[model samples]
Target: MKCEDFLFLNNQVCVIVGAANPRSIGYATAELFAHYGAQIAILDVAVTDTTQAALRTAMSAKVGREVDLLCIPCNIVDPVACDRAMQMVVEHFGQIDSLINCAGIVRSEGMLDIPSQDLALMLDVNLKGTFHTCQSALAFFTKQQKGTIVNLASVAAQRGGGLVGGAHYAASKGGVVSLTKSIAREFGPQGIRANVICPSMTETGMLDGNVTEEQFNQVVAGIPLRRAGKPLDIANACLFLASDLAAYITGHTLDVNGGGHIH
Candidate 1:
């Protein structure tokens, strides 16, 4: 495919989960998908999510919109909530061709200090949330015999996690990577593809609550690029994976960490 022709996601539906804010990877992915002509269904966990949904709508509108958009308030940790969110996407868009799992949370503490509840929170939001979503979406995909799923893993998933995150975070993300591969293996024959993106130290609000400048510099230095990854960097890769150009690809993990870890 030509570089220009690579913009292949046209008139598709991509349900982007975890659009917590404007700079979030979820929002970036939604924008990229919209730019390539995919309609968006943004699912978020908070009531305050409407603002972000509109912001993304406005951005896409500026680029010229030819389809309807829907924003759903949902918490994927609950199976009922996940069902409602997916049902809304189908009702609004007619069918769900893609699902991007970007909804996740984190709590930082040393291994010794990590409490059981925080550990469970990480697993609940990261791993369990993903499973709930994929479980619901898989049936629809299987029925259609065609669908795509892109999951958000992390650099922590590769290096056993960092100071800003912990064992639970890594374990959850590691489960995501493994689960993505399993989905691909089982469903590729059913015409469904699943993949994961692993990025590090993004400027998302997930870090807004606590990341210090000194800490940021140290994280950047560890990366060969000497810079933090951006949501757009991750979004663009997801945009491609959700397109026809990546039709033959599945069960693969893409790293958007700016050369931080070669694996």
Candidate 2:
């Protein structure tokens, strides 16, 4: 089977953290990679029968005949669990070719009104979690002499979006942008590429708690596209970064905000 030139990394294995549902960017990313002949491994904190994760993994594999996928349960806050998640991916796929950090948490309340626990959770999932996975991936990439990492940032990190209780979320995602750039600098010499994707108000379960129907519509109205983004919008990007097409891309945040960030 011939692979698309844009999919030069075909058959490469990618570990995606946080694929929870049809609405998850992680799931969309998994589907795209699988379609391009890349193997996939998923990790998530979703509360569901193990069958769900397995089903998603299988579905991702089914997207492309003969593609492979594996799913492992994990919570990024736990260091051992984080390492084990990577190990599972490597053990199943033989090597990890790429990593997409999609597991994140957001809490909505005014800054002062936000609970400290909520803030901690956001940091743990967004900032510390990225670090946990990146550190694990780094050792492997450094030893292999090449690798790719795509981190999910948020437009809030840049413009402060100023959402209710969004300060903590913004801080966490902001760290992602900075951490991504720094990681790129440290790993570039080793033939590793690291990048960030900042998406704005995408339709997903992640925002279910914060966005009401009216608020959602209001935000969409502000977008020049006059539409909210779908999970696929951000997932498609993981494909490009994982492929050789992005060999020259690193230390940058690609904003997929439907022109919301044009300002």
lDDT per residue for candidate 1 within 100-149, as digits (tens), equals 99989877777888889898888989999999999888878998999999
lDDT of each: 0.85, 0.83
Which regions of candidate 2 deviate over 4 angstroms? 1-6, 47-49, 52-66, 162-165
Output the lDDT of residue 211, model 1: 78
For model 1, the local distance difference test gives 0.85
Clashes of each: 0, 2
lDDT at 129 for candidate 1? 96
Say which candidate scores most in lDDT: 1
Question: Where is model 2 poorest over a 10-residue stretch in terms of lDDT?
Answer: 60-69
Error of 2 at 42 (Å): 0.4
Error of 2 at 247 (Å): 0.7
